[model samples]
Target: MRDTAKAFGEGPAASIYAGFADLVSIGTCIAEWHAAVVAATSDADRFLRAAKEKASIWLKEYAGREHLLALGEIAANVSSVSTSDDGKAVLSKLAKQPLPLGIFASHPKERPIFDGDHRSVGKEKPKLAVAFVEFTIDGRPVADIQHMAPNVTHDLELHIRISRWPEKAERLVLTPLSVESATLYQLPTFKVSAPSGDPPFTFSVRERAVFSVPQSFFSRPLEFKYGAEFQPLSVEQPVEVVGQRTLRLESVDWQRNPQTGYANIDQRILRIRDELRRWPTVSQDERAICLKLLVNLAKHVGQAVQDNVFPGVWSEGQFQIEVRKALRNDPSIGSALQEHPRSAGGIGDLMFQGVPIELKVETNRTLALEDCKKFIKQTTSYAVGNGKRIGILCVLDTSPKVNPPFPMEEGIGILFREADGYVLPVVTILIQGNLTPPSHFSR
Candidate 1:
């Protein structure tokens, strides 16, 4: 059970798996239990004699009519077994005899401690890291390499799926590299059947590593999260890989900034911050925090489009509720409030850290410049009412048209609104709706 819990994060089914180590452990425990029982009982012969006398006294005082009848029957059957009769014949006759109800009520049934249902239980799978290692042809590191295909400059991509975690440490150790097409695997050079004594490869977080690969080594394209044309070695591979480690989490100092070398910061929270850096804004520090909270919203909506989750066109308010759920579901942005009341009487669609976010949906069509202008004004009002300079406006383009996806920078823009002789920018981010699948494009 311990091994099962370690391997598959399940404990209840461990009893079915009786390995050599489990038998040895069980034997040792049983031996110790027998020793303890003997010590407690002192002399076994004396203990049995006293137990028999106590049973006789209990039978004499409280034996009911049915109990007395069962005792008489058992005694007569035993007496019938003469010294001349065979042992097998006497045992067979005793087994065939019908016994009275509750005949063994005087003594409790002895059961092994491990046989109880309270022994173990299944546990939820632990949050393990999903890692992907990519090697380029030109030795230049590329961002979002998992989504991109192997072009002239870029070559083969090797993905390693590792399940084991080191004890007491949070590091995700990638197992040895393997390419099924090739015979041998080497850590350095990334070539199959390389010379022996190649140094092992080590990976670090937020750092890049370059490796040399032989020409024409990787002819076939490797599989990706969205690109399912290339089959994976195993079905248990993660859809996407993020360089995050499952460390023993400790209490964090909430007052301190995570960017300033805080040790106890969650990697997922840091990942949101990393996504915020890619967002185009003038005040990256102040306005960017709002984008961090919206990262899950954008991704969730984007995935829904990719997976064709929506059955029909949803209302603007419905989109608002869904976006609110997406943000709230994220542990990093669990405090996102929906329909927060503004000081100027009306309620903002959503509020996070005193900033208001307005949501809009364009039914059956994509969002245009005019659509953003109308919504930005409303979002700006909510921001100014809440005593803030910047606000966010998210428009869900629920268009049924099969349009090409827009780049992140193109979908996001800053619209300036002047109030009280001061200019404030409302970050308008457009989420593309009803996008055609990549497979459809191939057809």
Candidate 2:
């Protein structure tokens, strides 16, 4: 048995460890066998059989019993004795020495430290604003305060109760309220107020979704040309007559045709000619209407011309290329144009890269003097706003030009000496002709 124990200890197989365990159980059984051997005479075999069976069962059931078996194997080898009394003495000595108590002694009971269902507020409590606490024991609700050491604020409320048999410890459940204020070190120096007053107005994300196109999209230059010889008509009132006489005379004078019953009607032609000669003097209303229509048409044409020029794309490729190249060559104009493409032409003129010009046209019909003044003021304002120094270019399209007595610099007012007058004012920023660079030169 001692040699067998030594062989088992030296073996590499895990089953050797099991064999060592069996060796220990066998030693214990041998102690029982010694008793049986001492007490029984003929039934010693039965005693030995029962002791072996009990030892085998114990070796199989005990955890880490293999380690004990290994120790037993060593002791048995050293003793090298076959007597059951020696085996009993070895077992008793091994039992007397202290053995490991294992992990069962210091094992802790598993329980949640934090109550997950309760909310805590104020100083010294859990940082979470909202939470829930739950307590239970023996598969039942055991709300006990003693078992839990909760660092709670004054605002919190604790709920406690008993749940299971054999009362172990008080289970605690904590609930927190909205904390109005909390002080440091439990000091009463500060107080907080509950949220009051109306909620602040908030802008909706959708409100800023409006789409807008840039002003540059609609910017362009407008040009108006006025032919010379325009003039203003004089206003004349109809004279009132003191008395008038109605005469009815019957003259049976007639002209007859000499051929095919058709008359030459030379006398009727003469009478019609006479009436036509007097028509202008008799029909003042028709003359007024004609004058008004002419004025309206002139106004419409001027506006239309402005509309055509301003914010208009170049229709001719040549024009577009020339303008683009010119702008690129002039540093000031090019820089301005690069910032706002719509102001390209105007910027060019303002920078003296091109000839700055303005033109206006008016028909024979006269506009109110105040209206003309207003027009001049507005045009000046617009020019100044656009960063340009402007001067008027007047054109007379009628027989005699209406020139105002005031200087053109003061306001573009024109006075006329004859009827059927047409006039226009062109506002322009003058570019120095001498400053024009060579066509080949680049800015």
Candidate 3:
């Protein structure tokens, strides 16, 4: 027999790194990676170099890699030097914006909130105010609009005011929240005076300082383009009359783990748990339903493993059948539709309240992370086809050499995916199969 201690660190470490890289690209571990990188050092230059290198590598692999690479390039070339106190204040303000360095100057303009057909007349426009019905922290709701962390519960009361109320406004459906950062130049061109000397000279300087501002105040509310639903108010007040809402917003930054000096999964989860509430659209009940499904699935997974239910080779169909059976047996989930045909092309493995559920059984000796991502995308397509805007992907891991089993809490996650111009939240559940009994392994 070989020394177990010596064997611990051996085998496919590179593959594991690649797997995590894939996860980060898909926004599965973005908050963790971002927090890690930001907290790694206080020197901005070091941060830029490391971020640039990583972004450069990721851009080649992930087609939908966000603006990090381009932003890195812009930030690297430009040196932020403040000659005056005003300039220092500008730099301080820029640091708070989502994209501190600003997106590329040549990047295409952002899509307008209202199209030509939906434009408001003159100064008349719809006003929206969000009041938190239930928040994790007192008053202020965490706003991780990207959904990079764990569960986000939004219990909100949305107050909408407009010049004209909808004729058929029994039900109000609000959109998901999207983020936009705006960069403005203080001055286009200015005359610059040379340094004091016997013969002082002046010249023209066309470049001006750019200041980025997060659209959180008035221009940009946490409102998405589509999907999240809201109910209209039942008050007897007139359409034009609306109550005022005041919220004191505060941001939580840099919660690092004691040992790692980086934010862990739980910390990231806690920091953003109440984020959805700020959007004013996501209902607490809807989130509770999804959470219930996930929690129950997790419990069933643990119990099934304990019972040694999955031990041999199983096909995707076989796995789906068994999973559906398990869910059906549970009194909570009475039944679920199987192999449900969608309006767009292929069929989904399961359907619950129109939400697509795609099941996969991995038979390979080594599970590739790319394959995992493909499994998610498959479910996302189904959800988009069915017009659910949400999906559940259950990947049953049955590899023989499965080491370092996925964590119960960390194993389950919700990641955002863009489909047909809308951001869809996809919940991923990893179900491990063919596990050795706990008594069989030495501590």
Candidate 4:
């Protein structure tokens, strides 16, 4: 019973072995096909050699005929040369004379010895005659020759000087010399006068000439910045002034007086008291400075206003002083007034990020200064609160030599650490000579 059970399990294993044998038979058939493809590829090299030999034989048989056909096609497309009237005239002149002979002798002794004897030796002895012709054409020396005759056979001796030869063969042709052909040759040297100068320059005998000029003749001194001028008000208003002043700071005009070597500044200022009466709130310091500026301007332009030369109304000092007293009593106004400039600084233009900045002004000096200081203080406080830094980039247009009193005329100074524990970084840049973007900051 144990043997019968073992045989029953082996029966399934035998069927699986039969299935694998069928798969192996199919793989053997694919291998045979791949071997046949390799054998065909191996024969291709021999076949290509036979094809190349056949093509070479065909080309050799037809090469001459193919070349002649190609030449015919090219000739059909090209234009033929026609003789012009000048060319015909030249040919007519040549037809009248006998063909010229060309001879070259290395030794002076070998040169023809012509003692007025036209006859030398008869037949069997070569007869020779020395025909000396110093030829020139268009004033240029062509050839100096002593021709030996009897050997001269053609219409023209194609003898050409290597240096003076035509660049193109079509321009001049050289043919064998013969009788009835005229020979014209150019001389080697032509006289040319030198340009008018200290030493009269002269040229040697040659095919071409060259001349030169002195370097001093082409150079001159260059003058720049002649009679250039600018206005003071157009000069950069201090950053402080730009932020504070109430002066309706108008545009600046630069005018020059050629006779006086001076520039006049026309600072346009408009005084409107009605606008002043409408201010709801203003600091006492601003009112005081405004009053002082008006009082000073009045005294300066008093005669001009009276004479009708200047057009503007002057303010009352008493009314200005009273307004200042009222502003001083207010706590908020007093705090804001404390930040104004302690001393008057020269006016300068405003610039930011290397560009000019425009601002509206009230034409009030004290108010302008106060606004400028307030801006500085606010920027300072903001920097302090955020732990960040503030930088001031000052740009000036004038030369430091003329505007020596201006603060920026001096080289830039940076203010970094503040005494009140508020730190701000200020960079003052002076733009003097050329209006080039500041190199101090990198893009």
Candidate 5:
């Protein structure tokens, strides 16, 4: 059962991921990182080891330096119990169990050190190259690094398959333990006899990058409305058999942005904003979200909300949150958008659909055309400075006097677009009526 209210952003961690914008840069990195790791490797042995080591270091910031010691502890934990007469039991338990996934602040689960569950087929008899690590996000593989070489062939191939979720915050998170390889017994604990290679590395959550599921992904008590699909993040990704083949990574040469502050702003935030500038290039899912947002705000002179979401209090911040939440769903809305002016809120409310959207809460009921025209003086600069063609001005009218022709639903009229470019279309959505059953804005 899912808590229907979860559709509304509510909870302790709700603000952590204000919307999809919070995950843009990280998600892109994870997707591209897996591809690079596989393309850089020559054999399954290298791929498996590299996946753990690279993803760990890549996510060093989030997982922290403490994870390094955690890996060693995990090696000891698994090896102590690994010397069984039949390794199948060890493999069986490893197969059944996976790394930690769900996170419940109220009732947290026990987290272990390393989460590398593996199998051992004699090296002499190599299995067809399988996934050294079938790269996954939330139990679904989003990309392919190198594959297990058939007969230790060392062949490689890469494939990326990204999934789309209905919610904005459902963006992907790359785990440290996501790997599939041709070589069985890839876990650090399985290496009984030392091999001649780079230093023998052990796999552990501590040694690697392990992202706790975002609070948004936390499953609700009923698993709806108030929560996300909370699944357990396992130590090892589920392994599967596949044909060995050579593959190439996406041609994208991904790298962290250089530290060039755009007037004292963080480089990470700038790069994400750069990506957002390219939002028109993304898919059309935003139209659905925009429509939903508009209908909700207009329902009963209030809001119709997303799919099943009901009308709640409509404030300027609430409008900003909903717009951020809605626009974040567009694949192109790839910026960890934040409030303007670091601490002090500025004229601009926030970024949505990759553009800065200003929320104008009409304190008075009567909103005439002249009032909207005056607002352009305040918002046109954001569009001009950001080089955006669309200027979003969301006006929430708690009173219903000068409504109608003033723009209800989405009013796209001529605004200003600084220099040469498309007409700066200011999308004005009017949400009228106070507590009364005022009709939707018309003509």
Candidate 6:
């Protein structure tokens, strides 16, 4: 294991050091290797003598191999400092707009968002693609990037969010709530300057990887580009990713979970639950229909997963992706809701009027008792203390075997909170996907 660890780490460790040579050797960037050589450039004889001393000891201790290898690294390091720099012919100084250290000297000619929206297998999280273009419309710190859309071609801005927050963090992150598909874009860019006396600082990563026919694309970092803040350049089209899920759909069986008789005072809740199950809800049934739609919408997701009818593949996108699609695209659930605006916290998955719906996809065999307790706490906090009598919580426990008739188990979740020594009610119908094979699947 020790040898294996070193073997794996050395290649990347070496590449990182090697890639360092190009960026800083010309002093465009300040790196450790560049600093060492820069501090001694005025005294070449002294540097050569020092190198000779180390070379003698290295050669004696490990034959010529280690000595030659170290020399190669050092030589690469020195070659960079002695070669062409990125900005040798500096632009003549001029009256500059006071700006921050993060901006560049000129618009970095536009490029694609790259592999901005890909999620690889065995990763902790997907790289949520974010594109930043500086703009200050009406000179008010806020910029309505939305008004300027019709963005780059084939560029899918599934989530569109423009931010106007103060610069407070290492960086700012903005999220667009609506997920829509469009190909072209006319994004904006604003002009800003770097602070006085500092070399233009642009930390850019330009990478290209080839994914052969059967090999999946690797996870790529969030697209970070810099240009005139108000002059949002035309970004390169997003790289369309294709993938395949490894989970086999042996079969699925959808059976509605049985519910016991409800207490007399809670008949309304029971009726709402029953109405949602059998769709084509009556015109007079005025009870909050969002929850009903969510429950019914979730059915398409179960069937989709059971039959392998999804478009994108995720070694990770299996359950969550499919379920979110159902909640958003299903006509019964999405169209029936009054306001589909999304909210964080307990507003649930797809909210109707303001009720939150939480989607829990458990790898566990079923939506266990513990899952019920966990969902109750989450939905309660999301309800913000009001007796939000209509929130929904859905659970999917994916299975290995395929049931020809995919199953959907529905139940009631009682979210009780003690307020001044009295219990509060946050109730809803719970959908559980008891997916995994009943008999453990072994290779």
Candidate 2 TM-score over all chains jointly: 0.16
Instruction: Identify the leading candidate in terms of lDDT.
Output: 1
What is candidate 5's CA lDDT for residue 44? 25
Worst 10 residues of 2 by lDDT: 202-211
The C-alpha local distance difference test score for the whole of candidate 2 amounts to: 0.29
Q: Model-by-model lDDT, in order? A: 0.46, 0.29, 0.44, 0.26, 0.34, 0.34
Look at candidate 1 and tell me the lDDT of residue 241: 38
User: For model 2, how does the per-residue alpha-carbon lDDT over 60-145 read when each residue is reduced to its tens digit?
Assistant: 45436555664444443423435665555666655554433222213222333444785544232111111112222223332221
Q: Write the per-residue lDDT of candidate 3 for residues 1-443, one digit (tens) a residue.
A: 02221222333332233323332332322233333333331232433344345544544553443433433333332233222332233334334324222222343233355556796434433433222222222223424332111122222323332333333334433332223222221212212222333321222122222223222111112222212222444522233222232222222233321211223433333332344333222334434444445544555455544465677667888888887876677676666544555646886677766666788888776453334666777877887686565577787777674354444345456666665666766667666677666655555
Clashing pairs in 1: none
Better lDDT candidate (2, 6): 6
Give a tens-digit lDDT track for model 5, residues 1-443.
01221223344233222222222222333334444333332222432343334334434433333423333232223333312222233234333432322233453323344436744332221221122222322233333321121122121212322122121222222221323321321211111112233322222111111112211111111100001121232322222223322221121111222122121212222222223223442223333333333332233222321122323335677656766665555444435554552212335676544455666767555564345766774565675565454555666555534333322323322344344544454544444434322354432
- lDDT by residue (31-78, candidate 6, tens digit) is 322333433222233333443344344334434444235333433343
- Among all windows of 10 consecutive residues in model 3, the one with the lowest summed lDDT is 185-194
Question: Each prediction's Cα RMSD?
Answer: 27.2, 50.4, 26.4, 41.1, 25.6, 26.6
* Error at 47, model 4, angstroms: 82
Mark the regions of model 3 whose C-alpha exceeds 4 Å error after superposition. 1-289, 304-307, 335-339, 365-371, 402-404, 419-421, 437-443
| TM-score to true structure, per model | 0.35, 0.16, 0.37, 0.13, 0.26, 0.27
- Taking the tens digit of each residue's C-alpha lDDT, what string does model 4 give over 1-443? 22222223434332223222322232232333333233322232332333234334433433455323332222222122122332233223323323212232232232343457674433231211111122222243432211111222212211112112111222221111212112222112222222233321222222421112111111111111101111232432211101110111111112321111121101111121212222323222332333322322222222221232212222333323433443455443443332122111322122222211111212222121122333344334433332323423222222212221222112222334355754444322222221123342344
Q: Which stretches of candidate 1 lie over 4 Å from their true place?
A: 1-285, 336-338, 368-371, 407-409, 418-421, 436-443
User: Highest TM-score: which candidate?
Assistant: 3
Q: Is candidate 2 or 5 superior in TM-score?
A: 5
Model 3's lDDT to the true fold?
A: 0.44
